[model samples]
Target chain A: MEVINIQGTDDTPNVILDKNNNKFEISGRSLPEDVNMFYEPIMDWIDGYAEAPNEKTEFNFKLEYFNTASSKIILDILLKFEEIVESGHDVKIKWHYHEEEEDMLEAGEEYADIVEIPFEYEAYTD
Target chain B: MENSHENHSFLDFAYQLYRTMKTNEISLVYEGEVTQDITKTFTSLTEKSLAKSEESNAVQRKVFNVMVECLQNISKHADALSEEEDERRGIVMVSKGDDCYNIITGNVIKNGKIPGLKENLEQVNSLDKKGLSDLYKKQMKEGRISDKGGAGLGLIDIAKKTGSELSYQFKKISDEVSFFILTSTIRRNN
Candidate 1:
């Protein structure tokens, strides 16, 4: 699987999906004016990756902030991973949020509640 | 002798009240050259308002998201209201009340857009929470980016976050521009 990397802006987040290393990372602020355009390819890549087997799939989300629309799309991506896990693929999600931001931590918890993927949350000072 | 009983401090008393009211309502107004710079000020004001309310994290996030969308809506679509050439200018005010926070944004709208803006607000006012969520999800899926504006999700997002109906008015300023005032309130969760 080829890697995909997109830069973040004031509105969108950077998405890095390293298929070869089995590590996926999405970080930065996400408040896109048109959220679907920003998130569509990330979703598509995850969908395709689900079909192929990897040794381990680790998805890390380090988001400073994202709008509600982007939040829903992120949920959709997590749900897809849940399905992949159900199909017996080893998958996990690491949610990194700012230490002071309880909102981001709660958001991660909300997604974890709905999906079956093992979600681990870590806090950073920066 | 009867004229001597007339009140002499009427203007002074009224001026005192005016000062008190002005103090209670904090105003942070900005007039800038860049559209993006103007948006940053608005965004910071919104965050400060939300923090003052001390709402839960979820509610605060919702408010912030709606705020971003609304300001963007104004930046991209509102008619120029200031002397800045080729730059959009509008007013966004956040005032604290006893039990609610008031967010008021005023901008100039071109004559033709009045109907569409009115229609969207009317539709948004009619939806319940669940319905608005479903509608927002649907719009996110179908709404496309255009040169004109965003996914048209600004009003819906504001309505959903505020849990209050959007209030707006269109007043004729001239043949070319109309004043559009949009007000949304977030009630304190008890």
Candidate 2:
């Protein structure tokens, strides 16, 4: 498995998924110019990784903000992880939001209910 | 107040607003090729405008996000092939009002979308703060199975950001297309 990095933009977020260090994270603002174009590579990479898979896959999502289009893509990514877990891989998602942002905390809970994988919510102060 | 003469050109509309801003000496206008491009343009415009006067950065970001969401909503759902639409191909205007920022977005909505728009917006406007928050969570859990395009979260975000209710109107152009206008307001902090 190989790691991929996409830098954040004024309208989009930064994505860093490193297979070597076993660290996968998505952070920053996420209102992309073309959401499909921006997320396709990330989706493809995850699909490829789930084939060989690791002992446990931990996804760290720390988004300061994201748009509606992005919410769907995040759901799509989590659903793919559910498939990986169904195949008996250990997978957990750590959903982080700013301590003051209650909306984001609830958003994490919503995704947790939709996907099969366990999602742990954490609030952090910047 | 709406113009009863019904001028459909975006340039005409922009010029009108531009004249109003020049008199006040405290606003900016932005144009771009796409919805996201235009959003970035307006984001910078707002940031620079506010920073010039040394306004609150946090409040400016919230207002900017609300403005961007309103614009994107028009770009994603606006009806196509209209001659009146601007060169960027959609009409989203953000102007500085006396004590607030006003966003006016014009788009074309297909006939089928009007019913859903009315229903969802009605539900949104009817909800209290707690109710809207709960509805946002509920919709998120159910996913985007019913949306015409995306998760239909923009309106909710707009509502939350400004703490203002959405105001909309639909002008029937033909059997298939109706001109949709959405207006949202953000109060400026002194």
Candidate 3:
């Protein structure tokens, strides 16, 4: 499958989905004006990746900030990984937040509770 | 002499506006069309101002997030007062109190939207934190994004982050339009 790499901007996050190198991560801020237009293709790629996926998939979400619209899209992306898990594959989400950002941690916990997948949190310092 | 007199009066008006802002603890104010580029500029400017004040990281993020949502709400939902004007013009102001920061925005909206918006705001204001969280999750799981690119979750999300009730008012502007003002407060100690 082709790798999906998108550079981050002031209003969008950087995304990299590569099954070849076993790298899948999304990080940075996300507050795009047209969220559906920005996230549709990324969701499609994930759907394709789920078809012939890796034995173990670890997706990282290291978001600095995201608006409510992007938050919904993030959940959809996580749910896709949940599907991968239900298909007899191992999937773990590494949720990264800055040490000072308690709300981000809580956000990850909330998503973990909603989705059936396992989540490991990683806190970092700037 | 006429040009000098005009310049003197302009400076006086400017100084008066500056004094009002200072007295109100307002750090930023913008009144015009709110596009994506304008939203970006406002957020960045607020970010810089918050940094200079030595606010906590969490508070800075909350203020920034609320400001973005408020600005985008205007961009998506604001209606021009007249048919000839097609811009989403609105006013946004950021003020700091001793204990909290207030994000205030106002825009013209159709009078027909008043009832539904009122009910929504009342419903959101009535919820506690847990209820708001549940509503947010439910909406995220089920709510469809509108043609205007809203997921109907902005208010709920703002309530969740700030842990404060959403305060709002609608002033009738004409037979067909009203000015809607919304203020979200974030406590610094939180």
Clash pairs detected, candidate 2: none
True-vs-predicted CA distance for residue A83, candidate 3, Å = 1.4
Order candidates by TM-score, high to low: 3, 2, 1
- Top model number, TM-score: 3
Model 2 alpha-carbon drift over 4 Å, by segment: A85-89, A99-102, A116-126, B1-19, B22-34, B50-58, B80-88, B95-101, B110-113, B129-149, B171-178, B186-190
Off by over 4 Å in 1: A1-14, A32-64, A68-126, B1-22, B31-34, B45-56, B81-85
Candidate 2 residue-wise lDDT, A46-90, digit = tens: 999888788898999999778777887898899899999999999
DockQ of the two-chain complex in candidate 1: 0.17
DockQ, model 3, C-alpha based? 0.80
Q: Write the per-residue lDDT of candidate 3 for residues A24-75, one digit (tens) a residue.
A: 9999999998899999999999999989999999999999999888888999
True contacts kept of 1: 0.09
lDDT of 1 by residue, B11-121 (tens): 667678668658767444443332545655566666786678657655565556656766777777778653465666677766657776676777888888888888889
For lDDT, the strongest prediction is 3
Which candidate, 1 or 2, has the higher lDDT?
2
DockQ of 2: 0.32
The clash count for each model shown is 0, 0, 0
